[model samples]
Target: MSLDLTLCPDCGAPAEVEWRAVMESTDGPVEHARVRCLRGHWYLLPVASLAGPGCRLAQSPTSFRE
Candidate 1:
């Protein structure tokens, strides 16, 4: 099955996500993504996958941390 793209659970809006940077953390390179909803709900997604853009995964409702 084709994997579904990342979407805002609050408004069901498609997440406008892009890689911001790779910070050096204790775990290693922490991939960061900037996501914003149509309603201007900004969010930062901390993930490990850096395959490429347009890659998104389901995030928790409270995943919008800073």
Candidate 2:
């Protein structure tokens, strides 16, 4: 999986793109990426929406606590 760098929508920190794939959804094939921030915040973002203007993480993020 190729890694891409993006800003964490929640923390505004650097995030790492874990992987991307096209999934079968009700609408159609939607591309998504799993990203993790330096603060261990995880988010699943739609690839297309990332390019749109004023894209922000309005949804709550997922965090795995150890």
Candidate 3:
């Protein structure tokens, strides 16, 4: 399992990745991650999960509004 570095909005702590999915998009491939922070704040974050690209996660252009 990998760690999602997104800090909780309510608290300052790294979040835990619960699940991940890669979807094909017109822009390219996008990865969605379901995370829960140390404070138990749950949210969905769009990140670049592509391997051998960058060491850090990049936010998606379109936020997961749903």
lDDT of 2 by residue, 1-66 (tens): 434666676877757778898999999899998888889998898876452334332221222221
Query: Which candidate comes out best when scored by lDDT?
Result: 2
Clashes counted in candidate 3 amount to: 0
**Which sections of candidate 1 miss by over 4 Å?**
1-5, 48-66
What TM-score, over all chains together, does every model reach?
A: 0.51, 0.66, 0.49
Better of 2 and 3 by TM-score: 2
Distance (Å) between predicted and true CA of 50, model 1?
12
For candidate 2, list the clashing residue pairs, or say none.
none
lDDT of 1 by residue, 1-66 (tens): 332246654676656564476777887788677767668776676754422344233544333443
Per-residue accuracy of model 3 over 1-66 as CA lDDT, tens digit each: 434355444554555567888877799888887877767788765754322223223242122222
lDDT (Cα atoms) of all candidates against the true structure: 0.55, 0.67, 0.55
Q: Which scores greater on lDDT, model 1 or model 2?
A: 2
Rank all candidate structures by their TM-score, best first, as comma-separated numbers. 2, 1, 3
What lDDT is reached at residue 13 by model 3?
50
